[model samples]
Target: MTETADAVTTGTERPDFPLDRRRCPLAVPQEYERMREENPLAPVTNRMTGKPVWALTRYRDVRQVLGDPSMSSNARNPSYPAQFHVPEEMLPYIAFPFPAMDPPEHTVRRRMVIPEFTAARINKLRPRMQQIVDTQIDQMLAKGGPLDLMAELALPVPALLFCEMLGVDPVHIGYFRRYAETTTGRDSTQEAVAGAIAEMDEFLDELITEKTKNPGDDLLSRIAARLPDEPTLEHEDLVAIARVLVIAGSDTTANVVSLGTVVLLEHPEQLAELKADPSLWPGAVEELLRFLSILDSATVRVATHDVEVSGGTIRQGEGVLALNGAANWDPERFPEPDRFDIHRNAEGHLAFSYGNHMCPGANLARMQLETVFRTLFERIPELRLAADVDKLSYMFDAHAYGLHELPVTW
Candidate 1:
């Protein structure tokens, strides 16, 4: 017989907790508060398509779920309904790569990327990251007052940094931008997303071909050189590898820059303190990352078998979301999770996440932000948001997160 209403797991059936939960994190303006109060480990029906999902709101629970081995991220199952409703053009490509893979296959492909992402290796990109940041600052200063920080500082830093790391021409960042924005966040029509993916594939194919003949000192060339040795990585696998590195390399950090700037602006005293003491800039970057941990879902993981999680139970083959933002805000971890203090030792925040699949470009991201922060304060000491704080745009309502635009000026 079919499971009756009384047969639902736990004492009571999960409340629908009907939130818009559309292309954004969840419906309703005060989401963080509601999630914390309504259900620390709240069970809610997937409002996007009326499916079932467990929304882990508390910081401890989110971390436990993310780090848990039982959770699985396989999206190929026919029975598994879509957890997010994204524009057709961007849906196929967003939030895949290592974040969505299970082990063995995941481990195989990720090995090619791990060494390249090591703290030592990424640190080598520091000087180059500084150059890109300095160049953008010069341009922004030339424009005088009233500039869109997103365009002036945020976009260019990562765009140039990623292009350099990939050994591609920055002039063609527009190509990646279309795909990045559509898939990472923002809206894209079906045709637009499809075309973007096709174009991206074509770009990757050509890049791999070019790198094949003339490998450079960059990560792309290194990954390509290593690909032949790894039995699991195929030509398509190479392309997928590059696809995520480029898109994520550009998008995730750009959002950090965009949103982090706003955070600094919101707290001017902290901004002034950071400007006066450059040593505090690194700490400031970490604090901003934790405060505005824009990337909504830390990582998408799935269970290989049924497992009992922190305090809840997730059946095997189930999808789980880890909240980097939530963990950063855990009072147990941070003395005052909500308070933004640059002086605070913010090194432990999982803004970059932890595990074998941690962000490959975290060093590059930190470098870009560091350079931007140093140069920006030197240039525009009075930098502040031009638009009302509430008017700023948020990102990746589906499975991902960040900002759309951060309109700021001196």
Candidate 2:
């Protein structure tokens, strides 16, 4: 059954929720716009679930659902929204530490790693981030034009930074990066995902043991420090935490850097404005975050109790997908939502989401982006796409929405 603005439909007539990546830069799906204006909380079929779930499109409704305590993020819940079907053998392995937990447990697990992501900690890394950005740019310049930007700069910047942060031995980065790619890429096969997980589990188990014996200032050592009293996080928990951190921190920033660069290049006027004034970099980052919301469904909440939203009622046990892309485009919240104006204040945008589950790595991602964007155009003023924008291949099936490879010339 599908719920529409004025009536309900059965079987063959369900309103389909299209979740494909955008073909045009900075464009929200047309279906999202239609639902927001017409059926703000329409019941549409999740292609993966084959069940009618609430697709909350309006900004207010999406934010409310994100912040609502009654809504559960735990995938273990009977009615929890699992975007893809998990194999029976893998059910127990999918309970990710914090992002997939709720309440006190979520709060506790997050607290363990909070110190690593604090503003001061992130601020301390700016110099190193700048160095990484510089080295990548220097190599690109030496190689001269016609480089795949994704490989030359975008992918390496964050991958190297994450390795430094995690204190993984430089020798292991090759395999680690391969495992991460397989695990996070949506198009990766089940066998590949399982192999990646097993490889990571073995590596992290040894790393955590080593860190326990000789603790360092890195995050793994910090987790080792908590092992004694935090019985909730056993050996398996430590591996889970490390795996999640690695998967979460790497590609997301890389994609943002690539996609954000494309967006800026598309609007030479905005690019020139930013290049002329470095002071605008911070605000420009925020606008880019808002304008290029990579995830179609950033926050998926399962209602534990009946809740009345602005448009309609979300029944208990029903899954609700809050589309950040749609909410970012809501006209009520952002004035002239479609326009990409770096001068506009896009501060309150839901790019990193809101409330308790907001991405902890947001500050780190911002600093990297600010540094990279500031330095790239400043160094190579003639930078432009090597091929027509339409000719570039995009990662529609990746965990993060980005170009498969951004070819560029300077």
Candidate 3:
């Protein structure tokens, strides 16, 4: 497809293979545009398995596959060519909480847990989210010097919220945070990530045991309470679900807090407008999610049957990538796709994905981001980036696209 522009037939040969390996693929907009224009679906050697596989880059194509029954979401397929193994410790959540399942199955598992992230449910947590925001800002102010918004604010709010939601003991939150970062890191070695996963597993194993007797009002307890009557899922499945709820909820929202701050600081006029009118916070948060594009990879899927996607024929059993980041910025979908506007029409953005597998944590993440943006702008009207914009660092190879640290101050 597209004449195989720069067709790469060989990659490095190494153990763990292409897992955790990242090659910068989108440094040029034209390159991204070319793929979108001429080749939205094309073949490339599977970075892990060394077999040719399909990559779906356009919005419509990616969405189609996301909703396609012919493609499976089991990320643990040993034959599935992945860029990385999720490590055995994190294996329980390879696609748990219904993220890695197909419908009928995903639908049932997801329905069993939907009440936790419902609009009404998350709204009840907003004040707590706001309080976290307020307290973090107060602490940042008290520090009275250069403040990295990510470390001081963005990263913690979600960690605390997720810990509250999953019934993770606050005293042990420091332990889980390490795993959260490691599991989410694309550049981190497998050994370190495996250790973090082991730590989380051991910690959660003990918590799950304790919750059986002294269940709290958190998600793990609620889901655990349902296991006896639920025929499709077991105790292990439920425990795995709780693990995903904590990890996905924490990492995605934290990135939003961190990257969203960088986006606002880069756009001072919009930042000023936000400070003046806090009412616009929710829309602004959604817009930031669109602009920042944290998730660079698609939720992986395996072609269960031969399917023609975007004029390219993918064989049965071939691997496919649903490139949401490329799709979210599609010119045909978003007018002036590359520009960032706080009020941009984001009806089609895929930052949290779409279809039956759409992120269950979307409402909670938006709430946390909305609250942080509201508080940060309200209290620090003159907030701006502390370093030269060009010099600011980004984790280009990260599983999620985000700033390494957002240094900001009033």
Best by lDDT: 2
Which ranges of candidate 2 are over 4 A from the true structure? 1-18, 22-25, 229-231
Q: What would the TM-score be for candidate 1 when compared with the true structure?
A: 0.85
Top-down TM-score ranking: 2, 3, 1
lDDT by residue for model 3 (288-308), tens: 777666774646678778777
- Give one digit per residue, the lDDT tens place, for model 2 in 293-342: 87667578888888888646887788888888899989999988889899
Model 1 stretches with alpha carbons more than 4 Å out: 1-29, 47-49, 78-96, 186-192, 396-400
lDDT against the true structure, per candidate, is 0.66, 0.80, 0.69
Higher-TM-score candidate of 1 and 2:
2
lDDT of 3 at 69: 81
Q: Could you give the C-alpha RMSD of every candidate to the true structure, in order shown?
A: 4.4, 2.5, 4.0
Tens-digit per-residue lDDT, 252-357, candidate 1 = 7777777677777778887888778888888888887777666645455555665564445666555454556666776677777778888888876777776655
Task: Please tell me which model should have the higher TM-score, number 2 or number 3.
Answer: 2
Each prediction's TM-score against the native? 0.85, 0.93, 0.88
Put the candidates in lDDT order, highest first.
2, 3, 1
